[model samples]
Target: MKSKVIQKIKLTKDPISNFDLVIQAQKGVDAEMAFEISETLLMPDEDLSLILHLSTKTLKNYQKSEKSLNPIASEQVLKLNELRKKGEQVFGSVEAFNNWLKKPAIGLDDAIPYQFLQTSGGMDLVMEELDSIAYGDFS
Candidate 1:
């Protein structure tokens, strides 16, 4: 009789703010079998309205298609492709571009957040960060 291996793993990180909780998990029996998990435990009824509003907005965006995507978003996708091509020319592969695209758009909180005005700040911040990196100004 052969014995099977059982492995378990857990990971966790503190929330960015005192208002929330963050937890993560990973498990695997071998290199071939693995799983990951993440959890954000929100306070009971803590700004439930805001959470629902944000969720609804995200669902709407996720439902959007190439045809339904706003002009700006469509343009952004095109720009991303262009940048991807440039990266391929320099790096010899589009792996970097594909990796970037595969990332969840969570950092675009301002663009995705529900409020028209409040979200702009976040988007602006993200754009500024991108610009700084693009201009070779790491400071």
Candidate 2:
């Protein structure tokens, strides 16, 4: 039984990169993995729920389910993974990236970047800001 449990845990991929996980997430990753990915991204349950447009009870249900996320939810998770991965890469660490997300940014018109990850257009704006940061454009 223990070995079976271990094997079940091992069934999940150990992704080489966050983007790799994003690919998995887009294709309907297991619900448990969604929680794990949220942790990996340093996202609070509230943030994740907002990003997913899901209720807290829904998230709790997903946590308890043995099934994978539906296509819509999976795509949301993918978007989140993209943002978290890009943030970490750009800021060089999760700590710096999360800090930047919380702080107001001039590029975002003084809005917190992390809150924008809840939607695609907002995510695009945040991505553009990160791109500018990466290229030293800042404009």
Candidate 3:
């Protein structure tokens, strides 16, 4: 039997299907991927750095060397991706979700959801609020 060359894949194309892609991620996200995520979220470099708990110099070093993120940072990236997917699901569009993120939400104590996206637990709370929105139980 001829040996088949299996190509490495991105694990999951959609966040809904593979919500724990971060846990499965071995190589983690690369610098290029990081940059793309930042662009997708419209996050400034400083904010990205804060969320990843990385210093500006460390980020610069990664970019300068074109390295993959550490597991912690990779996990954060996955969390962000999950939040993004959930946001789109709730708002019907990414643009709409982004706009909603900028506006204060009554469910979240009138805090902008975007401001709390810096951590996984915070994102989880945001997702919970989104759930409330979906169920028309905004309390």
Tens-digit lDDT string for candidate 1 (42-128): 112222213223333442444342112233332222222233333344334555433433343344432322122123343344344
Q: List the residue pairs that clash in candidate 2.
A: none
lDDT of each: 0.28, 0.69, 0.71
**Model 2 per-residue lDDT at 4:** 44
Best by TM-score: 3
Q: Any runs in candidate 1 off by more than 4 Å, and if so which?
A: 1-67, 96-139
Off by over 4 Å in 2: 1-26
C-alpha-based local distance difference test score of model 2:
0.69
Candidate structures ordered by TM-score, highest first? 3, 2, 1
For each candidate, give its TM-score against the true structure. 0.26, 0.74, 0.77
Where does candidate 1 have its weakest 10-residue lDDT segment?
Answer: 31-40
lDDT string for model 3 (47-131, tens) is: 8899889887898788788777887787776677767777787778878888888999999988998899788789889888888
Top-lDDT candidate index: 3
| Model 2 worst lDDT run, 10 consecutive residues | 6-15
Q: Candidates ranked by lDDT, best first?
A: 3, 2, 1
